[model samples]
Structures are given as C-alpha cells and as structure tokens.
Target: MHPYLQIMIGFARSGVLGYGGGPSVIPLIEYEAVKNYKWMNSDEFGETLALANTLPGPIATKMAAYIGYKVKGPLGAIVAVTAHILPSLIALIGILTFFYSFRSSPFISGMVQGVTPVIAVMLFMMALDFLKKGSKGLGVRWAMILAVFAFLLLQILTLHPGIVIAIFLTSAFIFATYRGRKTMKQNFEQESREKVQ
Candidate 1:
C-alpha cells in the first residue's frame, strides 16, 4: 500500500474511534504508529509524545502531522492531517446531530456509562507505560524524586504547572551539564595518564 493511503487509513481509524478526546486517541495512535506500522520505535514515540505535549495544539493533530511527515514528507503530513480531522469533522456535523437528539434516551446514556470506564482504563494504562519509559531514561531514583516533587508542588502546594515544569526542566538541564563535564574531566585525566606512560 502507498504510504499516503496508509497514513489516511491509520489516522482515519484513530480520528473516528478516538472517543473521550485526545488522551484516548493518543494510545490508539501509538498502537498504529509504533506497534502496527513500525514507523517509530518506542523511544522515538515517547520523545514525539513529549514534544507534542509541549507544543500548543491538539495532541492528535500534532501526532498525525509527525507520523505523516515521517512516513513520507510535507504532502504526507497534509494527507494524514486531513484524513485524521475529516472523519471527526464529518461525524460532528452529520452523526452527532442525530446522537444529540437521542442523547436523552436510556440506551444512549447506558452506552456512555459503559464506555467511560473503558476509557479510564485505557488512560491509566498509557500513563503507566509513559511513566516506565520516562523512568528508564531518567533512572529509577531520579524519576522517583522528580515524581514526588512534582506531585507535591502541583497537588499539595497548588503551584502553577508551568512553574513546576520550569523548575524540573532547569534541574534536569543543570544535572546533565554537570554530569557531562564530570565525564569529560575523567576522560581527560585518563588520557593524560596514558600519555605519561
């Protein structure tokens, strides 16, 4: 199959079935891109997800664009984004009108109630996967420390999320710089000792 068509199909599936909005759609997209399609490895997908969160836009759109571009190019991005968005757009205008009218029905209400728990579980599973991935890169000890700090700041202290994020990013940056310099200094000293011999 053509990459363009694959992009359309993959994203179209995600956009159409992605109930409960962005968080739900993300795991579906991850399954498509990382597992089924093999377009990106788990580590790359993790980075892409992180970058998408930092950007100012819908997560689904950001992910669609990234995956499409990776598969092909600029044109692939356009096709993927359009495919992803068009389903929801059409559904919103077409199907949702009927759904809205029947929303008060017991059947519709029961359906929603049933689906909500599934969505919650999906979100929880994704959160655990992402947490494990993050912990691997940051190391278990640092990851625990950072997680505790973030929870305290955001949940207990009621600090703004942006401020908490900035604090953590700065801490990570400083730690990285110090670690790099220490490694370099050790390498230099080792080289000098070898030269003296």
Candidate 2:
C-alpha cells in the first residue's frame, strides 16, 4: 500500500473514533501518528497538541496538518485534512437527513443520554493525562490550580467561559514563557561548561 494512502486511512479512522470533538481526537491521533506510526515522540505530540489548541482551526485539522506536514510536506497536509474531515462530513449529512424522521423517538434520546456520560468519562481521563504532565513542573501545577479556581468561579459566579478562557490563556502563556526561559538559560550554562572543559 502507498504510504500516503495509509496516512489518509489512519486519519479517517481517528476522526471517526473521536466522537467528542477536538480534545477527544488528541488521544486517537497520538496513538496512530506517534505510537503506531512512530512519526513523533510523546513530547512532540504533547507540544503540538498544546499549540494546536491555541490556534483557530479544529484540533483535528491542526493535528492532521501538523502530522501530514511532518511526513510528506504540503501535499501530505492536504491529504490528511481531507481524510480527517470526509468521514465525519458524510456521517453528519446522513444523520441530519434522518434526524427529523427520528425527532419524536424516545429511543434516540435515551441513546444520547447514555452516550453523554461515557463521553464525560473519556474527557475526565484525558484531563488526568494532562494533569500528570502538569505535575512535572511547579508552574504547571500552580497554573492548573488557578484554572480550577477560575472554572469554579465561572460556575458559581456565573462568569462566562470566554472570560475564563482569556484568564487561563493569559496566565498559561506567561508561565510557559517563564519556564521556557529557564530551560534556555540552563542549556546555555551547560553548553558554556562543556566548552570550558
């Protein structure tokens, strides 16, 4: 089989499995592109996931584009993105076409209720995975604590998600920059020591 074909199929499957949108898609894409395909390491995957979330587009598209670019450049990105989108597009069209026909059914609503809790569980697991990474750094830990507080405030004080996102993003950006500067400084000192020896 052609490598590009494999890449497309990989992305399509990931998209199909990622029913809860972008955040849920991360684990699936990571499994295929990083673990199975060996296209990148976990750290690279994590960083790309972070950067993608900050960008404007869908997380799935960003991931497909990034992985595709890494593998086969511009054309690869196109192929991966199209593949990721096509399955969902087709499924959505099909469902919408039939939605009115099923609108009055209790069965459909029951299925939706059943699925919601499962998706919630999946998201909780994903959060734990991120928290494990946050545990590695004091800044990350504190930032996460602040985020939780802000979230609680949003719920209790009736603050909007947009406001919460702004605060969280601003704080995260500052903390990440500080952590990056510290890493660079440590690297510079290590390089200087090596040169002296």
lDDT of 1 at 19: 88
Candidate 2 on 1-197: residue-level lDDT in tens? Answer: 67698789889999888877867777789888878888898778877776676567677899999999898899999999999999988998898689769987998788778777777887788667767766675467675886589669778888755466566678879989999999999999999999999
Q: What tens-digit string does per-residue lDDT give for candidate 1 at 99-169?
A: 99998899988988999999899989987887798788888887787788889998999986656766767
Model-by-model lDDT, in order?
A: 0.87, 0.81
Q: What's the true lDDT of residue 133 in model 2?
A: 69
- Which predicted model would earn the best TM-score? 1
Error of 2 at 139 (Å): 7.8
Error of 1 at 16 (Å): 0.7
Prediction 1 TM-score vs. true: 0.89
List where candidate 2 sits over 4 angstroms from the true fold: 139-197
